[model samples]
Target: MNHLRLFLLSIVVLTSANMLPAGDWPHWRGPNDLGAAEPGQSPPAEFSDTQNVLWKTPVPGRGHSSPTIIGDKVFLTTADVAAQTQSVLCFDRQTGKPVWSTIVNTGGLPREIHSHNTHATPTVACDAQQLFVVFNNHESAQLAALDLNGKILWKKQGPFSPEQYKFGYGPSPLLYDDLVIVAAEYEKGYIVALNKKNGDVAWKIDRPQISFSSPVVANIAGRDQMLISGLGKVCSFDPKSGKQLWAVDGPAIATCGTLVWQGDTVFASGGYPEKETMAVKADGSGKVLWRQGVRCYEQSLVAADGYVYAVSDDGIGYCWNAETGEEMWKKRLGGSVSSSPTLVGDLIYLFNERGKCFVFKTNPEKFELVAENQLGDEAYASPSFCDGKMFMRTADSTDGTRRETLYCIGE
Candidate 1:
């Protein structure tokens, strides 16, 4: 009888572990970049700077990169303007306390950046043991790998120093298997994959023009390929060999964020010459099944069920049919927005530049606004969802004071 009771207890433990909801937003656009979470879960209907926020932790310096959560820890990067320092910060997910900060002082290089840009504009990606961060200083573009406890494992610097736009490096790193891939589409356009363990060059492919978009991994037609978008084009490359598989040209402007893949279809959106959104068949041959011009800049598209949800840089939200490229609904909101929309169950969350967040229903037939909340600051960085909590960061103030902070919104 005792043995049977113990066996039953063990079974219950295993089942509970497997049944727990997957809420960890480990990367830029959450797990796998689909931006859709498991159904039946929803964030709080109303949250503000003072209410319903689980914790608000102060982050050093200013950066536009979003926060990535792994296990019980959250990781982000920032740049100290006057100090000319780039640092990666770790926070305790549960208590919102600072864990450790690893500063990389790349001296004299940040002077070349635009006044609005910073040394840290890219978010860090981490697996179990290592975190990958990208820093674009004035003279050097670098990617570094650090341990969870804040030890630098390896660092790699780029050869070319190109003039960045008003914003610095907005391309975040993507991690695959044992490699950290970087889209260094600057003066010398190259997509380089480094061995994640030791920072050795695994594969590098050169392109014609530099872009600000990050690379996305997709399994198309029974093979894995990295889909990257840049100035006037989108292409897929063999992830292992860095060989181009297919290319489609004519994107109006520079790509800003990562592409989202759904089934065999991928959605990409950006703004420079206005907003252009398209859905390409990920057949491993880079075929365009259907393309529609939905104007959005700097905002990544999120697909859920049968619809694609997007927010324009100017703060307009739209829902469209993912299959037919038909517009469903469009609504104007409070302020300008750049963070991607996140779908948690049937609710879609959108955050704007002035730190206002709007929640709406995910129904494809209509636009149902639910709640609008504010954080009392500016938010240029994207919001991340993990462990039933939403993490967001505010931009810095104009007085060179770091008013940026990380907020964990949850029950």
Candidate 2:
């Protein structure tokens, strides 16, 4: 396998995402950035709170960020809304116990975020020796690095408060080579790369216009490139040097899901103002193969083989021929969906907003429903997989009280 992942992440645009024997899910979209774990592991096809669950731990606070597993430790970011603080949480992967918690931001919480949004929304990313996390606290995006034991290594902030659209920050920090990259797309936004060692500015660029998508790095069209879609454009940049390789007019002006690619074609989807899904060639020729009206708002799409699969924001599942943008099949999985589809071998795991877990085959011929499992009544965050378990973040909002729990689901 490619040794490229001791860890891969976005907070997620994870093209920098997914992993193996390293057996860790240290990034958002996973080590491969494709929302798929390394193929050998067996995370249960049907699992619930008591069934197929090896362990479960109550998370201290709430955040939509996914779990990031590295070594024996699992990491997540949370914010105490009443306390106005944001912190990094560590958990024991074996017994589902609390390991340590480090407070990263104490105050400066934004006055108004969307009712559905939280102060801590980015997944923590690590590069072997250190753990890195991002939070939209005190009106700016703060990036912090901590040692494996929860000691703060360094913390840096980039201004990101927008005047009109303040939905709160969502992009996770992306790691490439020696730098950690972050995209804070407000009206006056930027994509900045910082030195992982001391959090210094390596290179920075202005991402005007405002888009909420995370930046992901992938090797497509024969070269390593960083990709993100928003601000009325689909763009590729040189990951090492921060140079614009190529950019084309986009599928829309605002997008939340990270871009996913297959073969030489890059796929990007929805956001505010307009909604559409598109496939663009990544050869710097800026050719757009096809465009569709399907929108996947807060969740990213997964591209595999020659086909792409997605669960639309409205609770519908879709399979499209990646090469031709042909709609092979789309099934209504029901309820709303905020979590992305996770591909484990030929089986794909999907979770709807109401906490419905759907497992299905990747056969493009039709919608193949394998199994359906239900967890908490509310699930907004995505799941992370490693070894033989699935780390699922779910919550119970019954009786109007919200409590979040992280469940380790396995065979």
lDDT of each: 0.74, 0.86
> What's the lDDT for candidate 2?
0.86
**Where does the lowest 10-residue lDDT sum fall in candidate 2?**
1-10
Cα RMSD (angstroms) for every candidate in the order listed:
6.3, 3.6
Q: Write the per-residue lDDT of candidate 2 for residues 1-411, one digit (tens) a residue.
A: 122221232222333332232578878888777888775666789988789989999998789889999888999989998888899999998998999999998989988877767888888888768899998876789999999999999999989898888778888899888899999987788999999999999999998777778898988887999999999889999988889999998778889899998878999998778889999999999899999898888899987667899988998999999989999998998998988899876788889888889999888899999899999988888889888789999988887988999999987
Which candidate ranks first by lDDT, i.e. highest?
A: 2
Clashes of each: 7, 13
lDDT for residue 149 in candidate 2, whole number 0-100 = 97
Instruction: For residue 15, give model 1's deviation from the true position in Å.
Output: 19
Q: How far does residue 193 in candidate 1 sit from its true spot (Å)?
A: 0.5
- In model 1, the runs with Cα more than 4 Å from the true position are 1-23, 38-40, 112-117, 164-166, 284-286, 395-402
